[model samples]
Target: MKKHNWSIVLLFLLFVSLSISCKKKQPVDADPPEGTESNLVSAEVTGSYNSNQLRLLALAAEYDAAVPFIKYDVSFIKINYKTTYKGNEIVASGMLVVPKNMPTAPSMISAQHGTTFLAAAAPSNVPQFAAFTGYELLSSAGFITAIPDFIGYGASKNVIHPYYDEYHSAIAVRDMLTAVTAYLKKEKTAFTERLFMIGYSEGGYVTIAAQKTIETSPIPGLSLKAVAAGAGGYDVTSIVSAIIDNGTYSDPAYVAFILNSYNITYGWNRPLTDFFREPYAGRIPVLLDGTNHASAISDQLIADPTALLNPVFYANMQNSNGELALKAAFATNSLLDFVPATATRLYHGTADETVFFQNSQLTFDKYKASGASKLELVPVPGGTHESTVLPMMLNALPWFQSLDK
Candidate 1:
């Protein structure tokens, strides 16, 4: 079920002379019994990293080579826990990497993952998936790193992923945190109550969503200290407009994915032929079947969004006058209305064609205008979505680290 490749950072960075390698070792994880509060279903070892390996990962993510480094050997333990999704309680799993030994009380980090289509590559299933890299890196730094599989992945593979549905996304992470705490207690692992949230792309959206949920309805035990969101489609409406106005987008399949998701989740019941053109109309149902790898569809589709969509549908997608159903549904997840009080940094590449850099700029402006005191947008000049990955992560790790100091 291995899917995401967070290690893409290395490959991306290496394009400009990045060269590094390392090894690591650790004891296999001990099995734990199913417990309460979001029960800990299992904790199995995935991989280990020596100090050098940890340092390599840090460097690959563009972490400052000058920052004093620590060598806390790290290992991945996939934890399956109980969480609610779309109102039904279900078992979900995620990656939890920890140092072989603990200090007094280490900080906690919720490393929300970016978009992933394949179930196997989820944090809980495979240790080497690149998405686990950040978790491992943080764990080596003495942070209890948690990465939820979200829905439609990990233990809940059969469940439909809510995509940008912020409500369900927030609940899933919250429940996962509850499960992590319960498991840590059962293991007698020492960790602080301080929590940080960070992620990229879809993960970024989930991070913001969770921050909003915590602020709007503060959780008693979990306190959020800081947040970092990178290249997420925060302004949902603006994203739609970008697709329509540009006549093309970096990923046309996303349009189909979103349209189909809204139809199924909201019961719009809009048939494929109503929106898509030709064989694509017939092919989209299976392409978006949730069973295919995300790229399986995107790779097959052309970047020209207009080519994939029917004329009427494309025209309607241009603005609010048409397709009221989707507009309203996307509105529910838009971050424009939510003003995060926590020290939050929004990072986006000025050259990002996929998610659009303007998303962050608009969010920062609205937050400031709406009276949010602790919000800032960090722009990575000339960085594309992929190129910005390491920089965004590097920015977040230190910002979170600074909070404790």
Candidate 2:
């Protein structure tokens, strides 16, 4: 395995994580020992699901009858690997689904999953329904699927999840690849050098971020064949800007997750009152303490997202420069600033209220202007953020298969 540039990564994270949420703090690289790679801590055969099971997932995810029933049974493996979370070495768990009888070397598909609050719903825990359609459809479609539970989930759920922060989650994906590689080699499974990635919602953001990490710091022996990112907040700056601009956002928990994760990740240690208004301010930290479900967090905060935010912080969001640390972080995570060299496809719905459709549009335009000819945006008609996930994925899976062919 190739070691990533830790100093570079830490600098990026530090600049992205501001002192108050814009001042550049001293770059502190808390990365575990350089030699600490993905070591398999445990392994288990969860269960084997048949073609019918996969088909049911497709139907449930997207009523696409065109989804093929390959009849290939896939056995799931729960795997734990060593990875650094905010510089701390932790054993993180993820799931791998192998085609029961693949004749040739299967290709690698690192499907970064969307946001989920339940620890039991982590990929390693629920192979069948962890993220539902992404795991089942892609894993059963003849590719070896690997999904990381991410930090603060699965085996390491005790810590707060780094929501919307791409740096740590991308490292988790990279280390999980190491674990998956070890498992494949130990089992004597044949796999080609090709690697593909797909992510939706939060997954989409991670996919693009991981791809960027791979680009800035290439992973040895891994060739990213293609990327299908759907409904992701690719341009974190723009998305965060939308949140600030909006009056009443549908999902307030996402905002809370961003604040909480950034606080812990940057070591700011600011209390909830620093970001939120009273009552809700005191209530948010409890909701975000890695215990309450995302929906529960949403139910608890019904006011306009702006209403829930501190007046000073809400107004600071307007500054695009280093005036606000949160805005700086957003600019750092935004994907539009750089062009993807790999063949990439971004999918989103036109009517996405949750993520706002303009994110994809602006990103696509930016890519086009950057001379990235291979990148294209696929728009789903009348699809909101929630509604477009499956539809975008249905297209993404086949698109990945096409890339392989």
Model 2 TM: 0.85
* Candidate 2 clashes between residue pairs 3 or more apart in a chain or in different chains: 21-325, 21-326, 22-325, 30-87
lDDT per residue as tens, model 2, 224-243:
88998988888888887788
Report residue 93 deviation for candidate 2 (angstroms): 1.7
| lDDT accuracy of residue 93 in candidate 2 | 81
Off by over 4 Å in 1: 1-36, 55-70, 128-133, 288-296
How do all models score by TM-score?
A: 0.85, 0.85
lDDT at residue 262 of model 2 (Cα atoms): 87
Give residue 1's lDDT in candidate 1 (0 to 100).
18
TM-score, candidate number 1: 0.85
